[model samples]
Target chain A: MLTLFYILSAITLGTAFLTILSKNPIHSAIYLVLCFFSIAGHYLMFNAQFLFIVHIIVYSGAIMILMLFTIMLMNLNKADEKNKPILSRIAAVVAFCLVALVLLATFIKSQPVINEYKVSGQDFQSIKVLGQVLLNNYMVPFEFASVLLLVSMIGAVLLSKKEHINN
Target chain B: MDQAIIIEKGIFIVVIFAITMLFAMYETLAERKIAAWFQDRVGPNRAGKGGILQPLADGLKLFSKEEFFPNTENRFLFIAGPAISMTTALMTSAVIPWGDKLTLFGRDVILQATDINIGMLYVFGVLSVGVYGIMIGGWASNNKFSLMGAMRASSQMISYEVAMGLAIICLVMMTGTLSLGEIAAGQHGWRWNVLYQPVGFIIFLVCSFAETNRTPFDLAECEAELIGGYHTEYSSMKMGFYLFAEYASMFISSTILAVLYFGAYNYPGMDWVESVAGANIANIIGIFVLFAKICFFIFFYMWVRWTIPRFRYDQLMKLGWKMLIPLAIANIIVTGIIILLADQNL
Candidate 1:
């Protein structure tokens, strides 16, 4: 399990670096996808199969696709797509490095190491168990999530249609 | 599980995984041959006998082909598109029960790779992930047509998923269990649920075609408009993975359809086979029976593909949402009512 955890975590971080380092917009998008997938792998390693699938659905299935469609629609392939100049790029890189260094230091210090680990199997996984808890204990939030999705869907359609209406 | 059981399960997983890859490879050949027959032409007889070995020849061709990338934004996303699709397609097989239990050396050997009780749900979850492959591939292509294709895929998939989920909910309510093996067991000995839940079966069957991205529901790669669809920019082996994964999902999903609703490894008078041929021989026959059912579904998929025309986007959405969803909900309610009445009589 530790081996699995390390592999997934490395993939997550490595893909993130590649996501930034990759020159091509399509390549970056692909790396972003790789990052999302690695995160999903992490979810599975943590025994959250439902979360893993949901993450893939939300991020890989929908969000990344939305991004891809946006990129294609805008015809940003010939150039790097970023309008920011070289000066901004250098500053952004420096800031990113600083942020990463600090975050890494903090993560190492804050990492949780389980010694005598014990967790109830039913509590850890299973939709039936999750469903019971969700409806009873977290029903408000669960319902709210649907409302959030509805809001976003409406927003997207409205925004996409703005171009049509204006024309 | 003990060490020996663990070892056995490992071997079982390997075998099942290999079988899935092999079936998927062959399905590609079968699809081309089928399409050829429909067109009154011989397909790829040059590669091997009756074009049986054509898949390997095609695979080699893919490898030897030149690769090119259109200057595109987000090259990472471009590569990620097909990889996601391929992996997700293979993931669904983790829970499918391939055959009935085999008794060896006084030990009961289950035929599934992993009988994790939440098997059906797992398949649905993984199947949903295939949408990303199309969406991302299209987007990463950085072409107008590709983006349109991806957008079409996303909307179509999400809409159909509601009906698909409802169909599954109906099945779950009837079986009272989520385990695939248990589902197969329930449909044993000619007492298949298709007879009982014909409407449910039909809904599931239709949705499966869409879920697998077969023709009529294959809006993602409609060559008529989308210029090769999601994989327009991809070339060579990278492209082949996306195409191969679709067939892989098609074959595996068809198998799941057979095992779940149709009588998997079970036919009328299956008991008599065991009586005459003995347990070992009968179980082998059962495996063959399951294979025959899978072939029938594969043919059924092709038949439908050639028969129906591609749906307009709005029309597809309406069917999934208005017609299918409502019907599935009604089916669930009706099933509950019947089950309750039966319990009261008991």
Candidate 2:
């Protein structure tokens, strides 16, 4: 089980790094898809079947397809993209380090609490249990999340609509 | 798992793989024969009796054809395209309940590969992944037509998927389970889901056609404009994979339709049969009944392909988004209300 976890972690981290490192935007998108798939694999390993399938459906399936379509339509498969200016590159590096440091510090602070693995022997991750938890316990937050998504969807439609001068 | 169970499952999976492949192979022949019949032609009777060996001949021809590769940007992705498509096409069968349990050697053997809790969503997820196959293949070919086909396919699939998911949400609400095996077993002896959720069934049927890229919804590969579409630059076995994947998905989706709406492995007199002939014989018959339903759906797919003309791209999009999505949402709302009313006993 630990070995399997290690392997999946390797795939997740490797593909995520490749998503940034790949030159062509299409390749990067594909790598990001692989990364998402590996994360789904992790969910499956944790026996969160609902989360695993939903993650694949929403991220690897839908978001990645839209990303790939945009990349393909923009004809950005070429590897001849101009390098970012030195100042911007420096800013990116500094931002990356700061984020990494913050994450590491957070993990360290929470290390004692994360040490013990607990199995409650209660049904939690199955579709029924998850639905109950979401709809019953986290009802307000869940509805709010849906509302947020709906607003964003409306925003996307509005953004894509063409503005007619005559109209 | 026990060693015996492991062997049993392995053998079962192998049998299912073989069956799916064989069914897909024959589906191609069936499509052609049906199309020929529809067009008032005899079709290919040259291979075996009634062109029984036609698919084999086609397979041989594909294998012997020259494997041509365009000077594409990425050779790896070009090959990976059909591979992904074919793999995802076959993956959905894992959760399908082919038949009820059969006792053999004093052990009960479930005819399904695996009855995962979220079987329906697994099918949806894998199907959504199927778009990557066409997109990658089309983009890798580096042809304008192929890229355009890929874009059409991806958008069409994604759009239809929303409606399909919504339609299924209605069914899931009615059934109150995500497992296909349970859902199928629930429809024992004429309690089919379609009887209750006919509107949902219709929306799912249309969306399935769109999802599988069948005619009336096959704008992606409309040869009138895009030539061969995503497989425009593909040749030989690679091209065969694309075609085979389509037939395979058609077969699987037909099975899904049967399993979900039409009673899968169930007949009106199934209880009588079980009582009379014992569980083994009854279940064996049930398997055949399931296949019969599946075959009807497959025939229905071909029939629609032949009878209906392909939709224009705009019309297809309008139907998927403007029409089907709203209809499916309404179906869900109505189904929820009915369920709530039933629970309230008012």
Candidate 3:
């Protein structure tokens, strides 16, 4: 399972890199989807079923679909190849690379690798345990999440809709 | 590292993969047949008995057809779109418990190909990735229709996802279990969670329909407007892949629905089957039972597809943001209150 996890993670990381590097938005989007699936696989490797399904539903299902809509609405598929100022693109790439390097180095140093151990416990990824914790221990945060959703909903509606026509 | 266990899991996965592919292909046939039936005529009965072999014939034709590559700019991205869609669609079944465990040759062979604790979350995570497939395919197609399709697919999926998550949260609250197998086990009879979480079930059902890119909710590939939608320019195997992946996802989504809402592999008299036929055989039979449930869902997908007209873009957005999300949130509140009252009584 550890080996499988490592393999999946490598594939995910490699795909994420390819997603960014791909000149075409569609190609990048597709690669990004693969990266998402690979991450979901890692979630499965850890036995987080509810999270896995939700990951697919929210990220792959909803967010990706929105991204697709944005891409189409903008008609940016093949237009990406239109030559831009080379210096700017090069500078942007360099900046991104520097950020990636710093982030990777810091992350590697901050988190020490631990020896692998046999997985043990009741495997409380079950909905029952999640419910108990969500309703009791994390009730405040849970309620807040709902409030956040409500705000976002209102924001989306307000942004999408025209001002009231009341005269 | 026993050879038998390796072979066991390997065979199970391969078989499931094959079944999924076949189901997807059949779903295409079913979609067309259902559409034709709705229109009062025979569908494709030329290929085989009642068109049983149509999907295979279609596959062969696709394999033999010319793979056209329009002189589009993002050729690589265009090529990658269908591949992503197909891969993610099939990848989701890894954690689903198809049936109970079977004891064979002094070993308990798990019916599921893989049983991880975060199975539900893993499925969710993979679903998010699924967006890339469509987005990439559309953007790469270098066509307005394709791009538009991809865009619609993304926004529609994302919006519904929030409501879907909220709906699932209610159930997640009620059952207090995230692992699908346990969810199924918790509802071991006709006393399915659907009865308890009616609002959640409806919301989840609607979201699932939207998530799967089915009709009425399918603003992404509305053929009347988009002219064949995202795969408009795709031909040969590339087109086949996109279509195949849709079916595969439909089947998987239906299974997820059954496992979550319906008593998955748990009929009313499931104990009798285990008692009479013994655990292993009964479980194998239970797998068949689960398949039947999934077929009905696939049928339902087709039935609704033909029966309803697609929603306009704004209507689709409104359904997701204004209607479903609020309803789901309300359901959560109701469930919370119920749980609170129950706790007080106890």
Highest DockQ against the true fold, candidate = 2
Residues B1-346 of candidate 2: C-alpha lDDT, one tens digit per residue? 4998899999999998999999999998998899899999999899999999999999999999999999887999999999999999999999999999999988999999899999999999999999999999999998999999989988999999999999999888888899999999999898999999999999999999999999998888899899988999999999999999999999999999999999899989988988998989999999999999999999999998878888999999999989999998888888898999999996
Runs with alpha carbons beyond 4 Å of true place in candidate 2: A77-120, A162-167
Can you write out model 3's per-residue Cα lDDT over B44-136, one digit (the tens) per residue? Answer: 999878999998998999999999997687788788889989999999898888887878888898878776666676677677777778877
Could you say which candidate leads in TM-score?
2
- Candidate DockQ values, in order, are 0.30, 0.89, 0.48
State the lDDT at A72 in candidate 1: 50
Residue B191, candidate 2: Cα error in Å is 0.5
- Indicate the residue-level lDDT of B346 in model 2: 61
Write one digit per residue (lDDT tens) for candidate 3, span A71-122.
5566574656677799999999999999999999999788432221123344
Interface RMSD of predicted model 2: 0.5
DockQ score of the complex predicted as candidate 1 = 0.30
Alpha-carbon runs more than 4 Å astray in model 1: A1-124, A135-167, B1-7, B39-44, B73-76, B105-107
Candidate 3 docks at the CAPRI level of acceptable
> Candidate 3 chain B — worst ten consecutive residues by lDDT sum?
B114-123
**Tens-digit lDDT string for candidate 1 (A7-124):** 8889989989999897666567868988998998888776776777778777876677667656655655455455789999899999999999999999989735232123433454
Q: List the residue pairs that clash in candidate 2.
A: none
* Residues B126-221 of candidate 1: C-alpha lDDT, one tens digit per residue: 766677677767776778787787778777777777787788887788888788889888887988878878888889888987787787889888
Please rank every candidate by lDDT, starting with the best.
2, 3, 1
TM-score for chain A, prediction 1: 0.71
